[model samples]
Target chain A: MEIRIGHLYPDLLNLYGDRGNIQCMVKRCQWRGIEASVTEYQLEDPIDFSGLDIILLGGGSDREQAIVCEKLKTIREDFKAYVEDMGVVLAVCGGYQLLGHYYDTDQGRIEGLSLADLYTEQGSPRLISNIIIENEDFEMPFVGFENHGGRTYTGDLKPLGKVLFGCGNNGKDKKEGILYRNIVGTYLHGPLLPKNPHLCDYLLKNALMRKYGQAELSPLEDREEKEANLYIRKRFLERQ
Target chain B: MKVRRLMAVWTAKIISAACRLSGRQGVTLAGKIALKIDPGILRDLSSQVREKIFVVCGTNGKTTTNNLLCSAVESEGKKVICNHTGSNMLSGVAAAFVLSAGISGRLDADYACIEIDEASTLRIFPHFKPDYMILTNLFRDQLDRYGEIDLTMKILSQAMAMAPEMKLILNGDDALSAYLAMESKNDFVTYGITEQVFHDQDSREIREGRFCKKCGAKLEYEFYHYSQLGRYRCPSCGFERPPIEYDAKNISMEHGLSFEVEGRSFHADYRGFYNIYNILAAYAGAREAGFALSRFSQVLESFNPQNGRMEQFSIDGTKIILNLAKNPAGFNQNISAVMEDPSEKDLIIVINDNAQDGTDISWLWDVDFERFLDPSVKSVTVSGIRCQDMRLRMKYVDIPSTLVEDVEKAIKDRIQHGCGNLYVLVNYTALYSTRNILAGMQER
Candidate 1:
């Protein structure tokens, strides 16, 4: 099967190894004899969701974020429609913040696409640590590193997972990420894919199913990926 | 006032002595204790040195540039007090001064060359006013620790404004450093590599400061030396690289670089294009300090990358090279340097997620490790607190688990397997500990 991944704002909203998610998806698909083509959509670039199978959005520095927020507003309508159609979308740290209604930073409030019924607010003391989340969708816990200042409030959407370790979504909520239909948004950016091959394959399977109505993905050897994931998960869990 | 200064000095000396007696490295401890005793210690000592003081700050090359400048001034028959160690914070700067301050509350030095951490720039300038400050280059370093490059630039601008008389020495080739010149109006003297240096394809992936700092338009690069450090100009708003004053030309970096500065040829003791920039920055700072241009030859010839940076070892006829790579840019440069040698080699990358090492290990994914998958690379072993993370990153690029191993066991096993050429790339917090282990193995 052929998978087309749209990497949104490849220039502006790129930070914290976010491209690794794209790399993980491509490598895993290629390993299973699937052709994965990535198309980078930068600021002001017109994005057509018709041909895209999966969309990946990463974070960036605050300066870059401001520039991206303006450009994201222009594509908010198209992006929201894509999400409403149950298009496979994975938004990370800064990218996740922008998918919400607004991100209230110390400087000012940045208007998000309001794609999901969510919003974020900046406060004192950033929440940063190795995060482990328990989700029923996967056999193993979702493990990743999170470094974000904005606390997100998920409105009318189910949380992606329950926090087993580290601060997720908000420090108070014991919940991590917001899942709207097939959309996944999280602050967990160990690029959120390389270490968690289960999540990587889940997203791939979901994308395949959404596009072709069936996904019986043949699992490749995941010995290395499993060991890496177990190593981080155990490290954080043992500390707590 | 004298009594307070003396108390701080005596406590620092006692702490230094006690630390040495206990076989511990108390480099920054004494400084921290001295500040606790007398917060004004830095101000008093710096006032004594006044215009003779030189402060160096940057994402990379501050240690190298500060050391080189210190050596250059000292070689010119002037006494210098500098933080030779990697302690570049306020306490370290204060400690250097307190340690230098004698019982008479006077520093017995002609000049003071101090390295200031870029984040601590605003805090350092209010206390210690240096007559000259050299910024090597700015890159996105330890994100959690220093926010962003723009924040760092803002801090630097505040620091520059506080020290209005300070002569700013900046890297013109670096768009970020050059952008600093536009932010603040100090007596700015720029230095850059005028000629084309070694080109590495890996740099294209790590281009930072690509957007125009002045206008949000994309920056047009004539050619990159490495990671946005090149001749770049904005097509919009007309912001461009300033004219280089202490320009280095006729560059060659096969073994080590040789470049001409003010019609005089000089050779840097260390290899790498970054080191060449470090040397040029030092050369410019020393000249601005009123040192003769010809006097830098001896210092340049004798200078070496201090500590475990580019330190080599030979254990049982097997050559092991240790280099410090704190960020993606440094790691990529080390990889490029290592890949230059066509001989068979194995890499052991040790990544520590300690407090000093910016506990967030996500930066590993930012490094272009796929470039090292050539036939010359026999194996790639991973180690330290975040070794598995490194291994997972390498795995995505198709490097098998059999090739990647744990640190301690891999070193012994690699040696046992008769691996002759080994390159050990270590990040910050794990540098000294890993070096000691390698040293112990070498002695055995």
Candidate 2:
């Protein structure tokens, strides 16, 4: 089954070469005989997200992110109905913040759709570092670099992850991402699936399951077991 | 909180030490973290060491100016401290300050000459307060990080506001630099070019910041030396490039190029007429730092891009030259430099879709590749992740391209065939990878 991924703001939210993340995702999927194509959307460009299977967003500067947030603000209703209802979203760094409730930047434009329970305020300080997030529910370590000013505190919803190594963010609270249903939004950067093979498999399985049901996933029985063992070992060691 | 800050500092030190010990990047990693801990930490740390600081800042010419200023200042045989690793961030400066500054907060060098990053300059300037700040031309660069021209100008304007007493060595050709020096209350120096090259005289490519910031009038450019720069005049307000203290006149691409400044003619040992703005700024900044004019002139004329800026190499009858062109102005300068050579030359340009290189490939549209329509260029090769983008650009351009493919094969194919004088333009991300790939091909 073909899994379509939308690389939102391929131009704007591409600071620190975040395109490599999308390339790696497509490359890995192609290697696994999975048909995955990244649909890039730019400024003022019309993109219908109704048929899309997955969405990916990257990090950029405060200003560029603000422009994208403003641009995305117009299509917030489309996002709520389609993105929140069905499709999966893998947001990294600035991308994750944007997919959630309001990003009030002190310098420029701010505000985003309240899809997730995360509030961000800019002005205080930027958290720039490589981090390891531990997800208790999920058996893997999520790794990514986050360069953002503002602390995020979840009001009601469960966090996507817990801090494993390094600073997960503003406080030792160990919250990293917000995962609900098929939608997975986090501070984990692209090449996100490179470390957490389970999450990648989970995303692929659900994407395939959503499209072709359990019958299509039967071919991956033995392959999944072997890969899962190898993935667990590496994930465990990276956390250590 | 203090513990977290200390951990950040120690974490940076460990990363830097490990990197250096493993024979990789020396102090850049440590520097990156120091700034994260506190943007003002470097300046505060520097105060412990009693030494007058000198800063070199600009878009295209900071690296060149930094190198030039270093040479002239070192001529007096003073122990000059600097971040030569090209990490101009507060972290890098802080790391440099820590490594070079004594226990008493006194620096080993008589003077500190530093290369400063544009965005970080706003935050770092107030604290460091350099004795002399060499203001280089502000060009459109890393749009993902620095934003537009005017945004960068605001940050720089803020920096200028903080450091009033600091001597400014300004680039007169740059509208932004010229405007900054003109508006500054500090003692300032202006250095620029007279008339040279096919500067934005009669051209069509996006010139960022086409409108005047002061009067909100349509700013017109008589010539664009490099993006939004060059001879500009406000249509409404009569603000122009203030009279330069030193200027380079006779600007030409022909053999034996020289520019006259302050009733004196300056010559370059290298083909540096196009970047005379960088040269003159370096000259003035170095002179302001107490280097003699004779010493400044002598050092600048001899010093060329040693750190992979415009390095020349030869392999298998092919003269492979590499030049850094990360932005529009830089791209124009490097491409124009290739066209300046009368002899036919093979060309290769590698563009990456990496985070460091600015993933937005749209910057390629502004690069005046049409300037290379001259007869001197024979075959052109474009490569990297964004090779197709460059290929499409070349296809649109009037220039012809022989090969456009992935970097490894295109470069090797050209090198194997015995091409005469191949000039490769690589951005920051693709430079080392391309260099290593070429090195591997040569070994085989």
Candidate 3:
């Protein structure tokens, strides 16, 4: 089966090796004998959400974010429609911030796509550290790096996980990321997949299910991925 | 002023001596003590110096470029005071001035070449008016500490506003670096590669400065030498790469680097365009300090970068090329430098997340490790605090992983079984610790 991944604002919103996530998804599917293609959608590119099985949005700098935010406002209707159709979307960091209602900043509030019932406020001293989180869907704690200045309130939506280590979503709450319908928005990006194979598989399964109506993915012996996850989990847990 | 200078000197000396007795390097400690004793020590001591002061800075290559400029100036038979230690902070700059001064706090030198950090520039430039300020290039580094790339530009621009009369030497190829000269009324000279030197297909892998500073339009590159640094022009606005005053023309990376600047051919042991920019910046900077190009070129022949910045060693008959990469630009350049060799070689990438190394490890994803999947690579070994993350990043590239618990053992394992050259790429803290471990092995 062919899986199409639309990488949103690859030129603008790729701050923290954001391309690594797209590459990780592509490679995992390729290893499983499935054809996966990535279509980079930059500014003004037609957002044909129907063709895309998964939409990956990475993070970028404030200047790039401002540019992408302006472009995003123009495609809010199309993006909302795509989300309504249960498209598997994974947005990270700055991308995660843009999926909310508005990103409040010192300069003013920047309008977001509002696909998820969330909002972010720019705060002093950014939250940056190695983070571990636990979700109902995964047995192991999801390990990744989180660096964001915007304090996001998930508001009623099911959170992707609880903050097991480091600050997530907001320092006040233990919750991290948002999992609304098929959309997954988080500040984590160890490319958010290579280390956390379970999460990668979860997204892949969602995408596969959306396309073929079934996703009985044969586990590709995640020996290395498992070892990597175990090592990180132990390191952070030991530090505590 | 003399008495305060003497007080600062004596206090720093005692602290430095105590640190030495305890078997610790007192370079940073001495500076800290000197600054504590007299907050105005750097300013007071620098003001008394009859010699010209040159402040070299950027995200990367500050050490090598600073050292190269110092060596070139020294070759002209002048006493030069430099912070040879890797401490480029405000305290480190103060320590260099305090320690170099006589007992009376009177500096006896013809030149003082100090490397300043980009963030520290705002603090240092306000008090110390440099005769020449050389900015190598700017890249997004240590987001936790330095914030964003634009923030760095803001800091450096504010710092430049203070040094209105200082001759600014900048890398014309870098948009952010060249942008410094935009508002500065100071006399400036630009150094850049006139043409593309490498044929690497993955040239524009990670562009740090893509938008035009003037118009916010996407900048067009004639060809990326690496990242957004190249001969570029903005289609929306007429902003383009300034005409380079000192151009690195014929660059051939055969064995080592051989390039020409203004018809003067110079050879350097350093490889890659980044190092070439360092050498070119130094050449231009040295000339600004009134040193002849011939003398600077002569000194560069014997100048080797210090403390594991492209330092090489041999262990058990295995050739090891070790270097430090604090950010993506440096790391990417080192990767490309290793890829220049088609012969099969074992690779070791060591990463650390120490506070000094910037606790954020997300930048590792920005490095194009997929290029390491070349058939010439025999093995890939990962080590350091974030080795698993490195391994995972490389896994996507389809390269098999060898996670050695100890960095020393990892290098040894590669040397023990490897048949060809071993390229060890380390970041920040790993660079020094791994080098110290392997340096001992090299001696035996």
Interface RMSD for each of the candidates = 1.4, 11.4, 1.6
Query: TM-score for all predictions?
Result: 0.95, 0.61, 0.96
**Candidate 1 lDDT, B209-240, residue by residue in tens:** 89998888989877788877889889988999
**Candidate 1 local accuracy as lDDT?**
0.83
What's the TM for model 3? 0.96
lDDT of 3 by residue, B1-444 (tens): 657668889888777778768755687888888888788888887887677999998888899999988898888887898998768888888888888877876788888899998888888876689999999898878877776787888888888778888889999999878777876677888999878765655643878878887777888887778877788888998888889998988788887788888788888776666888899888899887767756766687789787788788999899988989878888888888888777889988898888878887778878878788888998999998888778777777778888885899998898889965998889887876788877889988
Number of residue pairs clashing in candidate 2, backbone atoms closer than 3 angstroms, sequence gap of 3 or more or interchain: 11
Interface RMSD of 1: 1.4
Q: Candidate order by TM-score, highest to lowest?
A: 3, 1, 2
lDDT for predicted candidate 2 compared with the true structure? 0.67
TM-score of chain A of each: 0.97, 0.83, 0.97
Estimate, for each residue in A50-148, the C-alpha lDDT of model 1 and write its tens digit.
889999988987668888888887787887787878799999999899888899987898888888889999966888888989889679888888888
Stretches of candidate 3 exceeding 4 Å from the true structure: B1-7, B14-24, B199-204
Q: Candidate 2's residue-wise lDDT over B13-46, tens digit each?
A: 6777798677566576676775676565565556
How do the residues A1-240 of candidate 2 rate in per-residue lDDT, one tens digit apiece? Answer: 688888787656654335445544564466568788878786657878777777777766566666678788787888777655656777776777786677776665478667666777664444545466777667655654455565666665667677765455455577777776677776654235544556766676676766666414323222322332343345445667
Higher-DockQ candidate of 2 and 3: 3
Kindly report the docking quality category of candidate 2: incorrect
lDDT of each: 0.83, 0.67, 0.84
